[model samples]
Target: MTESRCGYIAIVGRPNVGKSTLLNHILGQKISITSRKPQTTRHRVLGIKTRDQIQAIYVDTPGLHRGQKRAINRYMNRAATTSLRDVDVIAFVIEAGRWTEEDAWVLEQLKNYQCPVLLVINKVDKLEDKAELLPFIAARNSEHNYAQVVPVSALRADNLTALEQTLDAYLPEGPHFFDEEQITDRSMRFLTAEIVREKITRQLGDELPYAMTVEIEQYKLERGVTHISAAIYVERDGQKKILIGKGGSRLKSIGREARLDIEKLIDGKVMLNLWVKIKSGWSDDERALRSLGYDDE
Candidate 1:
């Protein structure tokens, strides 16, 4: 019998580089929330992919950003950098044709890790000229000695098989850490909050996405139906008013979209209750950050 192989793989990159998209594509499930907005993912989410003789535990971290103005930003940076320390393989995901100062900063941090790093250039499908890939790969490879460089379109799920094979090859031989059936380590309550937050990000204006977060106040399951009551936290009453909108129309729309996704997630009937609350300065307060579930540990 062939021995099973399992190891932790950390996916690291700057904000808006499609790190979450790549993890979702690899797991074949939407464990991480995504939006077009930068910093859409504010927490580290773990996704497990188990195949024949291989189990890859992938950590989808919040994008490492330069801003540490808010306590939440510090928490996110801590979360992203901490995941790199003990992983067996590090997948440094980046956009195919773009490099930024933030990306350079993240690369500098990767220098501290001794593990094999796979340079995954995501969003190749967006490149109009296919021949441009070789030069891009060549230039990128020269910057760092990656164990393997793979170009893939995470959005389109193109070249993922090769990427997966490369990851599988680097995984250390050992017994599987998680059972084959388990996809993620996060609980339903956590996922519910994330789903709600995703809806908020998608439904709200650009200015409001970073100011708000979802907290599941009550979660209960009875008679084949799940009931969830959540509070959306904002720093001020004005932000709260914007989220609630005229006669609460905006909040209702957010709830409607979130409910559909929650139902699909749990595969059961869902009754969702959403409330907007003012938590003034939660993002900047360490105590408030902890209360909002931003505990780095």
Candidate 2:
């Protein structure tokens, strides 16, 4: 009989580099949220995948970014960096043709760890010339002693099978850490809040400030329908006006989109009510950050 294999794989990269997208596709589910905006992921999400005897627990982290201006920014950085502890394999993800200072910074951070680093070049689909992939991979590979370098388009699920196979090979021999049927370590309430935040991020795009966050005010089953009330917090009254929109149309639209996704998530009917509130200086306040569920621990 094959021995059970299980270990942690931390997917780390700069903002908007498809770290969350890769994890979601790897697990064949949407546990970690994504958006065009940078730093859409604010927390470290665990996505567990069990196949036969191999169970891979993937840590999908927020983008490791520079300039921790706000308390929230600092919190995101801590969340991303702390995920590296005791991990078996580190997937150092980056864009296909673009390498910025932030990418270099993240790479530098990996040098301190002893685990094998896999240089995953994501978004290769966007590269007009596929031939440039080899040279780009070669250039990145030379920068570090990577265990392996794999190019993939996480968005299209391209070459992900090979990536998974590579990760499976690196997993250390051990008993399974979680149940074979389990998919993620995150709770449903946390995921629901993340879904709402994702919809708002996708809807508002650049118009939405980084100060926004979602808190589940209430969640319960009543008459076979899941009742959820979430508060969308912003830092200023003007931002509140922007989120609520004219005649509450924008807020309603956000609620409608969020409710549909939440229903799909729970596989049940949902009554989602969203309210925009202003809480001045919440983002920069450490105590407020903890209360908003941004706790680093």
Candidate 3:
């Protein structure tokens, strides 16, 4: 009989490189939220994929970026950095044709690591000239000795089977850390909050997305329906007004979409209540961050 194999694979990358999208597709579920905006992911999310005897626990980290202007940014950076500890494989994800200074910074952090680093070039489908891919891969290969190099489009779910096979080979032999049915390490409340946050980020413009967060103040199951009360917190009144929108139309839209997603996640009826609250400078306050469930590593 084959021995059970399980290991943690850290999916590291710069902001908006589709690390979360890659993880969601690999696990065949939407555990990590995604949006077009940079820094949409603020915490380290774990996605587990078990096949036969091999279990791959993927650590979907917040994008490692250079801008640490806010206290929350520092926390996000720390969360992503700490995910590198004691992992069997590192999947360094990046865009197909674009490389930035922040990407270089992420690579610099991986320089001293002892584990194998698999270079996953994501978003290859967006490359107007497919011919440019090989050269780009060749150039990046010369920079680091990757265990394996694979080009894929995480959004399109292209070439993911090959990526999985590459990751499966690197998993160390060990018993599974979690049950087979479990796909993530986060709680339902956390996921619901993230869903709400994703909706807000998608609806709002560039500046306000990063200035706000979602908190689930109540989650209870009664009879057949789940009642959820979530607070949308922003740093200022103007931001709150923007989130709520005119006549509460925008907030209703966000709530409607979030409720649908949450219901699908739980497979039950949902009564979601959303409210916009102003907590001045909450994004930059370490104490406020901790209270809003940002303390966990």
What lDDT score belongs to each candidate, Candidate 1 first?
A: 0.91, 0.92, 0.92
Q: In model 2, which regions exceed 4 Å deviation?
A: none
For model 3, state the Cα shift of residue 273 in Å: 0.3
lDDT of 3 by residue, 167-187 (tens): 988998899999999999999
Q: Model 1 off-target regions past 4 Å?
A: none
Model 1 over residues 1-297: C-alpha lDDT tens digits?
A: 988999999999998899999999889889899999989998888999999999999999999988899888899999999888889999999998888888889999999999999999999989999898899889888898989999999999999999999888888899998989999999999999999999889878485968898899999998888999999999888898889999999999999999999998888999999988898888889898898898885
Worst 10 residues of 2 by lDDT: 203-212
Give a tens-digit lDDT track for model 2, residues 4-74: 89999999998999999999899888999998999999999999999999999999999998889989899
Model 1: how far residue 204 lies from native, Å: 1.4
Query: Candidate 3, which segments miss by more than 4 Å at Cα?
Result: none
Model 2's alpha-carbon lDDT is 0.92
Task: Give RMSD (Å) of candidate 3 vs. truth.
Answer: 0.9
TM-score of each: 0.98, 0.98, 0.98
